[model samples]
Target: MQSLLKNECSVLVFTLSGLNETMENRYVLFSLTALYYPLIVFCNVTIITTILLHKKLHEPMYVFICNLCVNGLFGTSGFYPKFLYDLLSHDHVISYIGCLIQIFVIYSSILCDFSTLTVMAFDRYVAICRPLEYHSIMTNQTILKCILYCWLAPFFSMCLVISLLSRLTLCGSTIEKLYCEIWAVAKLSCFSTIVNNVFGYIVTLTFFGHAVLIFCSYIYLIRKCRKSIESRQKFMQTCVPHLFSLINVTAAFMFDILYSRYGSKNMLQGVRNFMALEFLLVPPILNPLIYGLNLTIVRQQVMRLLFSRNKCDE
Candidate 1:
């Protein structure tokens, strides 16, 4: 009888220990998801709504901002709900198809974001550098074509990369992080990921390289504008928002590179968390604030919108 009781006690202890570990991991994931997702949703929604309703924000610049907000919304929506559920339910297993979908959404958003920013920089360059031809160069049809290309180019690129990535088979460790990021899941694949890694590097170089060039072009344009005192003040105000947006985009790319290169068993989990925050959380929060505070038109429109809403409530 004593031997039987001792065996039961051992079994219970082992089970409790396993449960404790699971609970601890779930707690950590839940905290992270809660911290980042709400802020992302709020900021994206604010930017989208503000641009859509405010007639004053119907210009090319705000149109690009609206596109960016939409991209952020889709990107966050793709991963955060499932991530939150996985954390709360302690079910970290994502199926192959699900993983592929997450990768598609993430990469598509990344591509669109970079492409949109490139177009925005080009728009700024044309407006400031070639003021005489700004209207002719940025006609509605031309802007529409640019936006379409930005959307379609990234969609196809991500689809191709994901198709290749999906061919690889994952064999071990069904439990991933709160969400199924491409590299995180790829690490568990039984097959070689050399092609995927190489393709990822290519994608990074293409998108981020273009972003850097666009940023430099804007800086050059700003330098030229600074010769005139009035134009310099206006240029600074306009450039500040773009600079903030560039920082957000660049930091996301840099962190992605770091995560891809050094993410192994030896890598610190905190580093991964930091990368996620920079990539997923910071931009959404910062973009609207940057635009709203720096752009006088947007601030006035936002105030008007709020006032109209308050009056309606009465």
Candidate 2:
């Protein structure tokens, strides 16, 4: 059994073949990434720093927004550095342990986005639907718990899936994407991956169900908003941004999930790669902009900080 186990587990480093066709454009890709990644960092970090520095913005809703941006930074840290290196280097490979770590960081961050959005949806529901109870309900302890839930649940789930993947005897060392992902690695297993498939489905449905609940909550909120102009204005200002974020993340994740499971091989590699990358690329940039533009207090503070800094410079 030991000898059989050793024989089956032969893979040491995974050669990422996703960059094979794109090598000719590596420099261009590298240049674009060099410019783009820091922008992602800039956007997310600015939002996070803005929220933290301002005392007035320390409320539950803004706190949650700050957490979302922080998760964006966490997710991209797993991919961007390695991806940039791969773009420069001739060989695109990652060690088994490195691959597992990448999968854990990126996917958990994505899941945490879902969890954060869900919690934010609930925050809005309470604020709009039950204004009198918002403070009592969304207390400091509740915020801390929600933050913990956002981080822990996905971490635990991905840790379980990675533990399962680690136990499997992999027969291949070539990953088809630029970055490591759970399903990509699981597909390389020599034995039946029934457990992995089952768990993947469970995780998908569980988070997607979070999306469902968010939608339902909005449905009721919108109905309530219709009766009062004040409520209608609040919904237009605050809830609309949340709704945009929810839709952005959902669509991006859906593209990734569907493409991973059922994507056509005939599709262009660039298209496939884009589908894989959309979640990481879009949301990090979009969420801050959405919130920054819409949320009155945050926008006021941001603009105030910017203009104040200009005065200092002048």
**Model 2: runs farther than 4 Å from truth?**
1-7
lDDT tens digits, residue span 1-314, model 2: 67557746667789998889889999999999999999999888878888999999999999999999999999999999999999999999999899999999999999999999999998988988899999999999999999999999999999998898898888788888889988888888878999999998999899999999999999999999999998899899888999999999999999988988888878888989999999989998999889987888888888887888899999
In model 2, what lDDT does residue 145 have? 99
Candidate 2 whole-model C-alpha lDDT, 0 to 1? 0.91
Full-model lDDT for every candidate: 0.71, 0.91
Clashing pairs in 1: none
Q: Which regions of candidate 1 deviate over 4 angstroms?
A: 1-36, 173-176
TM-score of 1: 0.85
- Candidate 1 lDDT score relative to the true structure: 0.71
| Model 2 residue 287 lDDT score | 93
lDDT of 1 by residue, 1-314 (tens): 56544433332110001122355677776787697788777766776788898777788888887888888887777777876775566434565567678778876877787888888888888877787898899989988998997899888888878887666555544433445566765665566899988888788788888778887897798788868776677667776678678778788868765765665645455555556546666665677778876788877777777788899999
